[model samples]
Target chain A: MAARILIAEDEPYIVESLRFLLGREGHSVESVNDGAAVQARLETYKPDLLILDIMLPEMTGFEVLRRVRESEITKALPVLVLSAKGQESDQQRMADLAANDFVMKPFSNRDLINRVTALLPAKTLAGSGQAPAAVEAPMSSDRE
Target chain B: MAEISTGQRIRELRQHRGIAQSLLAEQVDISPSYLNLIEKDKRKIGGALLHRLAQRLEVSPAQLSGVEDASLVRDLVDIARVLSFDGLDEAIAGRLVAQAPDWGQAMVTLFQRYKDASETATALSDRLSQDPQLRELSHAVLTQISSIRSFAEILKDVPDLPQDERAHFSGIIASQADRLGLSAREMIALLEGNPGDEIERSQAASAVHEVEDLVNAQRNHLPHFETAADDLRRRILAAHGEGSITAAMLAHLETKHDVEVRQVEGDAFEGLVEEGVHLVDLAAPRTATRFDIARRLMAMELREEIEELARNDRLSGEDARQVARRAFANYAAGALLFPYVPFLEAAEHYRYDMDRLAQRFDGSFEQIAHRLTTLRRPGAEGIPFAYLRSDPAGNISKPYSLPGLRMPRLGGACPLWAVYAAFAEPHKTVAQFAAMPTGERFLFVARRVAKGAQAAGAAPAAYSIMLACEASYANRLVYGDPFTGGREATVTPVGFTCRTCSRQNCGQRAQAGILQRA
Candidate 1:
């Protein structure tokens, strides 16, 4: 599936790898290096999904999530929270803030790809089984 | 209620009256040797002999039985244990406290102040050497690890990547590893007690810690306070009828105690008592108003009982005892307002919900939280919960720990705990399952509560209150329901303090763990 994805991360090489991997997978990706730039970039980029790093500089991923959830235009955007903390409390906190999915850093590339595919709008990705009900309905119920 | 040793009190009264030991023993119809043994605490003296001794001493038997000089004797005994002399023993220490209390008290106070000052000096030195520098080094190391992990994974996975990208990734990894090595060396330097890090040791005494020691020694449960509170509650309900506890307290104060309760505006103090006129700030919250009234009533009604409870060996001096008096009064007021039996029943029925209990008992959130710690009433006790209160700056003001859950004594607690998170969203309760480095798991619920009445333009006094119990007991609490008795709870790794915790990989650790340093 090809979708507009926004990556909010502080690490440059990590961003480069993400951009390379996602662009090769046919997704159009835009990136912001800090949390403070994410909101403005989200408004301009209007991406279908946001990959957020929890420890972004200037502002935190938590503050960004709070603001995104509060904004009417971006409230329903699917979010994949990334963190290095690797604690269950962090995962639960992300879930509580309505993030679509949470992935600890040092995550598997294959798993990240699958989760991002699952979180993208169903119309943009056919045969994806895990399109959450709050997002658009799955076009085809092909369980993987 | 034998607050004092009858033998000790007897000896003191006899000495005060200037009665010779042989004459007193003859009047009391006991052998002089037997009286001497009793006065030395070698033998018990009570019943008819005690009454006779009091009669000869020209004091009531209650006075002889109620002095709490046993605590003094215990202090003297402790002093003797630490500073042993040729002829000193437990008997001589008891005799010292009984015969010359002023000298005994002065020695005990002096010894205790010395110990406290030494401990404070040690703790201050530890903080100065380790706290800030450790935090900075740990952050640098953790950040380096995060970057190194990501880049290393990228390098390993992307074999077909361009040459320049691979070399750039390799260069980043090497530099981060260098930074990590540097941080490790700095950590070693910190642990080895690097010089030029001395802190002022002038502030030695803390009456708060003394009271905390006393409370912790008793496991935060005082049966005497509970009984006094119950008696006061019953009397007020009987005299003033059953409406609200605050109303009943007001009526009881006005009718029985002859106290004039008045609401005053723009008072600097929240509550003040002078000339039998009780002034309560009109701007104070209703709960504060009721709490002040209840505290005043308890202080008035149970003064002697509270005093007896305060006469503990744990208290170092008058300041500690004075602090303990106020704390005891507040405790008695909580007991009076909640009335243990009914409160415990409600707590069980409501699944230990703080909000529900506060609503049912007409108390504030902090009051309900405080009452939760006092439920250690033997067989019918509630879950053993530790209580902690902290301000925004992470200064722990009130800390009560259960057996397995240790509260940090000298420094800030681990930043990852839910108690700190509660500060971000005031009044919103945050529940979490946290596991200590010792592998002990706890279910914690914390919320930021308003401290007291807010003045118009004041910065608003607020602090976070937390109640935590072993994860096994989480099933009994409403806040722990989502974790389903803590069986399936997702656990967050935590520590008592970063300096002592053994978990080396914790991203939030401020200092190298003791084991890590070693």
Candidate 2:
């Protein structure tokens, strides 16, 4: 469906695999490692889905999620958090923080693709906020 | 060289087999007396007998000849130095080897667990302290993660993302995974036991200690300085020493010594000498203020002698200058309060109780401890004492140890010391019979001082001051009451530093040092 996905992660290999799988599934991918940069990228890239890693420079994923949920522009942004810590308290905190989906790292490509597709389908990429109305309809039908 | 001896190993295995020594000697084709002699280390057995004995004992000759569990005993000694007063001596070792050998092994195993735990604790205490390897790995992980994500995004978002570009992205992920793995391994290995190169030296402390040594080298006594200090003491007492040595004493200083004393505003120093007028911090404690004036008066009276004594000191030019400036001044300040003879008599009377002595002299615990270390009067010497100061984060600021037991110049000290535990209970004096790795026991005492808040919103300054004297003199100290029973008395074992410690299984050990395997 050619969905635009923004991945916020620090580990490059996980991001690479996720990007490849998402690209194959017909989604456009943009990634920023700095958690603080997520908001700016959200307004500019306007990705349909945000894949966030828990540990990041300057700001952490949990901090980014709190801000995203509060801000008007990124309030409805579906965020899939990635973490290597995998502590129960961390998971519970993410859940309490209202992350849409959380995947523990070393995540498989299949797991990432599935969560990503559920958050932003190929067709919804246009409506996910940047593409024009004229292009949205054709991209939706082009998926079949 | 071997941690365990072949004879000890044979004794252990034979004891485990539960066979009579006579029967075992018959099987090994050696006389019972000869076997007994070999077991007791009175006879040397060559490789031929070593193999035959190994065969009879159903154990490998390597297990017998190699530095086996004897290394375990060395570690046990190291660990015991932290936990108790005694160790597995020759008699006990012989019994443990011949009767219940597992006891020794069990102790060794227990020590290893302790070593591991101590390491974990000290590492956590030093969390904010930087580890270069950790920082590097963290950076690498962040970079690799970013690269992997970026390359994958390129392959995903860009349509007809060239097949070559796709291949490149795949290769990066593969390469980065290896990089990440390497980074992870290094960080993990560091955590497992490596004490990396982050231990820093405090130049300020060494400079101060250099001055301390200059004073100490003279047996911490200055007869000429003492004579001059005595005269000043008599004069001050005759004039104003009947009352507390207060800031008001400046009137006498200006008239008698022709020195002007003035109060100032600043945190740069407790007091400073400016153009012969003594500018002291008005906000400082009254006791400290009095000490400063004493120093200034002493300096003015004994300038030539102080310079000559400092010049005679065996220190570098800069260090000698520092000593010349501080040693006499600090000595006068302290001597004015404690006054050697009375301080020593009071210390003996009070059993070196810093609190009681401090109250008697109207001084701080630190002031008392500092004075306690300097009681080396020729014929009537007090217990030879050493002092150590550290914070909860494992930073040792100032340390003094008796000759032959130089505490590690860097790091907080053995985590197992009661001084560390004293931090958990501030303002309380905690005592322990602590042994060095050499098994030389000492009566150790530590008290945590909460220096009160700097500002209303800020937390108070915290520190642990530990003092100790050789256990041989333990009877003279009331702190040694617990170990009065005999040589069988137990004591807490500790190391100079983790890196220098041979105790292998100390749970509190933060790093695996050269003595790691032992």
Candidate 3:
């Protein structure tokens, strides 16, 4: 489905790849390096899905997710946390923070696309009928 | 619990029954002086004498021996040690427990709380400060891998990528690989225990904790040292003009006390006194040199006073006493450099601008920061500020906090503190309003200060010093100028440490709070 996504990651290389990949998936992408800017951009950019990084400066993705869930306007904003801290406790904490999905660092390209597509608002998916082939392309080959 | 002699127990029972010492001795068929010695635990009693004493006191022989109260006394003494209740030996513990078992049980519950809180703090400190190298290395490696993986997948999946784009992604992957290799090597080195011996570090930490407890017990103020420092400062100002206090101190040391001052190249000891020569680090800043000289002067002029203060009853053992001696000397030096009334007046006048006070007093950033903590004079006090200094790696030293604000005794503080943030912007003051779980808010001011002169390529030795005072007193400091309204949202909720803090749903929480129910 075509949607707007915000990538709240610090690494330029990761952001660049995500921008390119998500752009190809027919999603408009905006990126910020730190957590505070994520909150600031959420109001203006208003991305359908937020890709959060856990180790962001100023605030962690966990804190951003918490505030996102608390505010009335952005309470239901779908969040997909991309993190290097992939411990069981972190996963539980992200779940408690109401993150829609979690993709660990050194992630497979196909897996990330699938999660992103799945986390986008169901209304967008219903309107668009189905996601792009890039979303499912890695699913079959990722098994190999 | 303390062990009580059977004779002592008999005497206590007799006293409880309102029997005179001579009457009890006569009833027990012993001389009064002999009974006195026995009551003092100097003489032993058993067999027929023990039975007779027990009968006269209306108790059994075993009760007279205090065998039933042995465990209670042990627990009381243990509790006393944990609470830092000075001089609570087994003898006193026995007396307290024997006299009132209900009060003894109350003490046991109090000790339980103290034990739980201390355990949580110690566990959190160990988790955060211990093996920091490993945590850093692992995070670095993972970050590098994430970058590498994204770029590599882009290269592999996007066969139709442009030439320049492909080259950029490839270059990034190569560099990230290099960094990953370096991180892996560092992690291996850390696993091999190359950093330091754990046992030695923990032993030193306990001694440091003892000294901190002693200082904290005294409210971080010593009037005796303050008086001597004031007198010495007057003598220095009178004998040698304030134009050069260091030179004047040197003259004072040399002429009055036959001591020689020498400065050697490179950073070493701040001031190492061997024989009659005082070797000061040549690379040390003027502030440190002057402070060291002042401390040396204090040691020379008031050695007896310093020694007496170091013998504080609160200090546990000789090691803690030795640490206290150095701490007391440093406190004396801070008082000498920044005399109580003048420093407090300047601090109030300047609204506690540390840099301005540093310039006014010719003190370093750290010297000024520490001096600010010693402003607890009755009826003439500045803001009561808690002081903490953390290295880049997050190990905190010389942590002092007010009553409501708890400071970690052994290791690093919570990662959410501005002290950690201060490292990101070296030399720039970072201030924040942090609220603890206890609903206490503090305005914390932090800045990274260089420790000593850096040798080329050797990692710069620096630490961030943070001073925190109650938020209510924020209006008195320049750092709190912008946040005078005390906006609730602007206050960042923080914790003492992860294990001890009971804040719920905190994203940065490292461990479940000990207070939380399963």
Candidate 1: where are CA atoms >4 Å away? A1-144, B1-205, B268-273, B485-489
Per-residue CA lDDT of model 1 for B1-518, tens digit only, reads 22346677777778888989999888878899999999888998666686677667866454576433454555454444333222345576666566666666555554444444333323434343346555444434444555555554565466597999888876876666556555544544565454223211221245676787677656688777888789878877887877778889999898878997888884644555577788887888888889999999999998898898789776756767888999999998999999999999999999999999999888999999899989987567888889999888987877887655766544578899999999998858999998888888899999998765577775668789999999988888888777773454377888877755788778887776554544
Q: TM-scores across all candidates?
A: 0.50, 0.46, 0.50
Relative to the true structure, candidate 2 reaches a TM of 0.46
DockQ of 3: 0.25
Docking class of 2: incorrect
Kindly list the per-residue Cα lDDT of model 2 for residues A28-124, writing each as its tens digit. 8889978889988888887777888777788977799889878877776677777542233455667777777767543444566777766764457
In the order shown, the chain A TM-scores of the predictions are 0.85, 0.81, 0.83
Q: Which scores higher on DockQ, 1 or 2?
A: 2
Interface RMSD of 2: 7.8
Question: Which parts of model 3 have CA positions greater than 4 angstroms off?
Answer: A1-144, B1-202, B267-274
Task: Sort the candidates on DockQ, descending order.
Answer: 3, 2, 1
Top DockQ hit: 3
Model 2 chain B is weakest, by summed lDDT over 10 consecutive residues, at B197-206
Clashing pairs in 1: none
Candidate 3 pairs with clashing backbones: A1-A131, B1-B73, B1-B74, B2-B90
